[model samples]
Target: MTLTKKILLGMFLGIIVGIFLNLVTPQAYPTIETYILSPVGKIFISLIKLLVVPIVIVSIILGTAGISDPKKLGRIGTKTIVFFLTTTAIALTLAIGLATLFQPGVGNFQLEGAQFEGKEAPPIVDTLLNIVPTNPFEAMTEGNMLQVIFFSILVGFAISQLQGRVKLVVDFLDQANDILMFLVGVIMKLAPYGAFALIAVAIGGQGIDAILAMAKYFGIVLLALFAHLVITYGSAVAMFGKTNPITFIKNFSPALAVAFSTSSSSATLPVSMDVAQKKLNIPKSISGFVQPLGATINMDGTAIMQGVATIFIAQVYAVDLSMGDLLTVVLTATLASIGTAGVPGVGLIMLSMVLTSIGLPVEAIGLILGVDRLLDMTRTAVNITGDATCALMIAKGEERHAESYSEAIAES
Candidate 1:
């Protein structure tokens, strides 16, 4: 079967196996998870991890080298960021609207002082500070994605400044990107095994009681996410790209699949870049800047989750939020999601921030922690969709910008 079919099959089998393990051989499930499943999942992750730095380096190098005009780079960066922020803001608003309308959090979910520990999210200025690494090697070693992006872009920019002498470097980098793409393709083939093992182990561990307890909340969060994907992403494509939403979805699926499986927008960057440029026909210059920045900020899915989840948790704890408080959540989550770096597990961290902002007990985080991974997969898919959507919109805008520039020149 093809990779996509295999992945779907694996997800199906994983759910079945997990349910069976939960019911029948519960004791043995841990052994299976520890020995067979976890290892496979880790192996899959390792392969992706191995590719991340090289992919970032080479892709940024290629993107920069392709930009003969440095002026275009600044313009591209500004436009990309503006588009990302706007979409992210809208995504948060949608999430909050749906959550409030659905009342997803209005039941008995005890708050019981849930612990929500996370790295202190730096201020926006400090976030900017973190982008430029003091040591590039240190950045890679720590797997600091934004820093890697910053350093790689600098490397690419510097390469661009060289007068024809750096053509060999650019050529070599092109070969490197090809090899990384091949490795990504190979790693994707192993997705079924990884997905199956990880899912089975996770579900088996979570148990049915937890699922039942959070069913309503789960449904609400999921529904909100679905709405954001269909409504927000679909509208963006229909209005901006002037393309059929279904066709856009079809083109976006491969990258979405990768993002779903990995649950890390940064990790999914290479594949996203490839699909955007190759399948969607977004220009290399556009995809390069937008995709990376999207990985950092355009977390529509996570924003949706934060919205529904916050309301769900509040309702469970019987905390009656004022309309003002709900709006506070909407605004904070929206801004926080936009500001959040699109790395794996950062959703939970951002969620924690949202909880703190609204005076919800952090301990409530433990309640959703079990299902967080599963939810994260879906959210990552949503995040990628938003990213891809923004890329297309910005590409369309850039085309318009160029047309305007050309017309102005002709008029002059």
Candidate 2:
């Protein structure tokens, strides 16, 4: 079977097993999860994580070195950040608009006994400042993505400047890039089993009741995510990248499946980069630079959740959100994407920040917490799609720029 087909099979079987465990043999869940699912899932995730830092560093350096122009790098960086932030803002707005129209929170909900305490997001200023690492090695150890990105770009820039002198270093990075990509291919062979175990654990742990109770809210979130993927990303890829939307989606399905299984853009980075480079024909420099940065800061999926959750929570609590408040949600969630980047359970934390911004009860987050995991999987797929879209668009733009420059020189 093709890899995508294998992944789909794993997901299908996982859903069946998960449902069976949840409904039929709830008692066996603990033992099954402990021995069978968790270990398999964690091992898969660990293997992927093991490669993330090194891959990001090596890929970024190679990508930037290829560009060899600070001005062009700056332009790509500007376009990438703009694309991420803009799409994220649009995602939040769509979620809020849909939630408001559907009124997912209008029905009866038991908010009295619900309790949830969110982790505090660090200040935006601090997040921005922290991008420049004090020690690049420490950043690599901790997997501080922004810091690592900053350091790698600098190394690439330096190599570009000293091209003749640093031929040995550049060649080494090029070879290292090849080796890491080979390892990525090796690791991906295990995705089916890993995806199965991960999905099984998620479904088995999250019982059906939570999903049923919040069906309306859940449905709205899914609809919004679908719309964003089809409308926003589909349009961008077709118009900017000059690629067929269906072709892009088809080639990118493997990464999407892994993203769905892991529910982490970071964990799925290796697979995503590979798909972009090999399948989509995105250059390493563009893929490496755009995707790693996107995984860290571009969170359209998380923003959608925050938007819908904020509106849903308000409705449940009978709190009326003014136009100004809705705008605040858009702005807060958009900026919070960057502020909360790389933090675990970031969706919930950012939702809390949005709620707190408008004086909503933070505890109301518990209302949707139960089904969040399922939605998280879907939204993660959406998140990485946005990342790939940006990478493809930027790659196409760079290609055109290089071609135009060559033609102009030829004429001169």
Candidate 3:
């Protein structure tokens, strides 16, 4: 079977096993999860994560080095950032708007005595300042992606300037890039089993009650995600990249499945980059530059969840959000995507920031915590889709711009 087909079968079997464990033999869950499911899933994720830092550093260096002109690099950077921010803002607005219309939290909900301690989000200033790494080695060891990206880009740019002097370094990185990609291919052979274990654990542990209880909230989030994927990303790909939307999604399915299974954009980085370059025909230069940056900053899926959850929480507590308050949610969630980037359980952490911004009780998060894992899987898929869309569009634009520049030169 093709990899995508194998993955789908794994997901299917996982759901069946998960439901069986949840309902038929609940007692066996602990033993099975502890011994079988957890280990398999963690091993798979660890293997993928093991490659993430090196892939990011190598891909970004190779990407930047390929773009010999600094001005062109800056142009791509500007376009990429703009696309991510705009798409994120739109995602938040869509989530909030849907939640308001659906009123997912209108029914009776137990809000009293619920407890959830949220991690504090660092100040915006600190997040910005921390981007420039004082020690690149420490940043890589700690998996500080933004700093690694910064340092890699600088090294790539320096190599571009002194091409003759750094010929050996450039050739070495190119070879390293090939080796890393080959490793990714080998790791992906294990995705089917990995996906099965991860999904089984998630569904088995959470059970069905949590899903039924927050059915409205879950449905709303899914609807908004679907709309954004089809309308926002589909339109961008079709209009900007001038590619058929169905072709784009079909070609990108392997990476999306891994993203869905892993639920970590960073962990799925290698697969996504590979698909973009090989399947989607995105240039490595743009794919390397845009995707790593997007994984860190462009969190449209998580932003949507925060938007819907905020409204849902407010409704459950009998609190009314005014137009101004809704506006605050859009801004806070949008900015929090960047400010809280790379933190663990970042979706919930960013949600806490949004709640604190509008004086909502952070403890109310416990209400939806039960089902966040399932929703998290879907959102991660959406997040990387947005990243790939940005990369493809940027590449197409660069191609057109280059053609135009060549034409102008010929005319001159």
Candidate 2 clashes between residue pairs 3 or more apart in a chain or in different chains:
63-285
Measured on C-alpha atoms, candidate 2 has an lDDT of 0.93
C-alpha lDDT of all candidate models, in order: 0.77, 0.93, 0.94
> CA shift at 2, candidate 2, in angstroms?
0.6
User: Candidate 1: where are CA atoms >4 Å away?
Assistant: 111-119, 338-344, 404-412
Top candidate by lDDT? 3
Q: Score residue 50 of candidate 3 by CA lDDT.
A: 96
Q: List clashing residue pairs in candidate 1.
A: 105-312, 105-315, 109-316, 113-363, 114-362, 114-363, 114-364, 115-363
Q: What is every candidate's alpha-carbon RMSD to the true fold?
A: 2.4, 1.0, 0.7
lDDT of 2 by residue, 1-412 (tens): 9999999999999999999999999999999999999999999999999999999999888888887878998999999999999999999999999999999999889878788988989999999999999999999998889899999999988888988998999889889888988988898899999999999988899978778998999999999999999999999999999999999999999999999999989999999999999999998889988999899999999899999999999999899999999999999999999998878788999999999999999999988888999999999999999999999999898889989999999999
Residue 256 displacement (Å), model 2: 0.5
Each candidate structure's count of clashing pairs: 8, 1, 0
**Backbone clash tally (model 1):** 8
TM-score of each: 0.91, 0.98, 0.99
Worst 10 residues of 2 by lDDT: 106-115
Best by TM-score: 3
